[model samples]
Target: MNVILIGYMASGKSTIGRVLAEKLNHHFIDLDDYIEKKEQISIGNIFKSKGEIYFRKLEKKYLKAILENENHVVLSLGGGTPCYGDNMNLILNDANSISIYLKTSIAALVSRLKNEKSKRPLIAHIETDDLLAEFIGKHLFERSQYYNLAETKIVTDGKAGTEIVEELMATLL
Candidate 1:
């Protein structure tokens, strides 16, 4: 089975994905890193050079490819992956996979992402805590529609990584 973890930036998709994969003994594929390797460019550069439309196309193709090509893998999707094209539909329709939304509060998200904004292109231009909070509040509200479609949702607020993993394991079982 493929375990797909979906969430907004800094919601711990990549970090949790790694630990989950280790526990499950499944390969962990971080979608952004996968795309970077395949395209031979950073996701940030891809956005700058090729634009979001092109990046979304690539994201769709690879998201599909990875699901089709492997089983027993933990795949962590980018923040916007489910919001683009028919991607959420594709994820929902897969029988061999289960998608989990790492639901986090906007306050928690802002706290997690503020220091990491430079690494994330979409919010890199944002300045100050107030601006970051506003941006995240709006973005999370918009993105929650797609995220809520996940088969399972895990609230990650104030929870330790191992605690979240334990919850995930319980849900999976």
Candidate 2:
């Protein structure tokens, strides 16, 4: 079986996925990182060079490849992965996988993302916390429909990494 972690940026999918995979003795694959490795280019650069439409197509292709061909894996998807095309349906229809959404509040996202804006291409230009929060609020509103389709939802505010992982383990087990 495979475990797919879905959430907005700074929601700890990749970080928590690595630990969850280790605990489950499964391979960990961050979809964005996998794409970067496979394409030999960063996702940011992919967006810059080929644009979001092209990048989303690549994302859907690679996501389908991973979901169809892999097992015993913990996959962390990009923030918008499920929101595009038929990706959420694809994920949901995969018989061997379970999807979890790490639901974080906009305030928490703002706090976590404020310092890391430089690292995220989407919000890199957001000048203030207020603007960042506004952007996140709007984005999350739009994306929540896709995110909520996950089989499980975990509210992550004020939770330590271990705490969240433990909760996840309990749910999975």
Candidate 3:
């Protein structure tokens, strides 16, 4: 079976996916990395040189390809992955895969993302912790609709990666 981990930026989707994949003996794929490799450019560069719309189309294309071809793998998607196109439907309806939401609170997300804002195009323009918090609050509210479509939801506020992996294993088993 495949596991798809979805969440807001810095919510540990890629980190959890790596550990979970090791435990489950599954291959791990960070969709952004996958896209970067295939496109021969960094995700940030893609957004800068190409644009979000082009990147989203590529995201959809690659996401569907992975879902169709891979098995026993953990796929960690970009923060906005589920919110675009029919991607949420694809993740929810796929028979061989389970979609999981790493449901992080606004405070946690702001704390995690503030220092690393430069790395994230979407939030890079956001200045000040207060503004970041406000942005995350509103963004999470909107994205939660798509994220909640996941088969499993795990909160990562004060949990370690190992602990989160255990929670996911329990659900998957």
Q: Please give each candidate's TM-score.
A: 0.98, 0.98, 0.98
Taking the tens digit of each residue's C-alpha lDDT, what string does model 2 give over 55-94? 9999999999999899999999999999999999999999
| Every candidate's lDDT | 0.95, 0.97, 0.95
Tell me model 2's lDDT, rounded to 2 decimals: 0.97
TM-score of 2: 0.98
Candidate 3 residues 1-173, lDDT tens each?
99999999899999999999999999999999999999999999999999999999999999999999999999999999999999999998899999999988888888889899999999999989999999998988889999998988999989998999999999988
The digit string of per-residue lDDT tens for model 1 on 1-173 reads 99999999899999999999999999999999999999999999998999999999999999999988999999999999999999999999999899999999889988998898989989999999899999988999999999999999999999999999999999998
Q: Give candidate 2 regions above 4 Å deviation.
A: none
Clashes of 2: 0
Model 3 lowest lDDT segment of ten: 103-112
For model 3, which pairs clash? none
Task: Order the candidates by lDDT, highest first.
Answer: 2, 1, 3
| Better candidate number, 1 or 2, judged by lDDT | 2
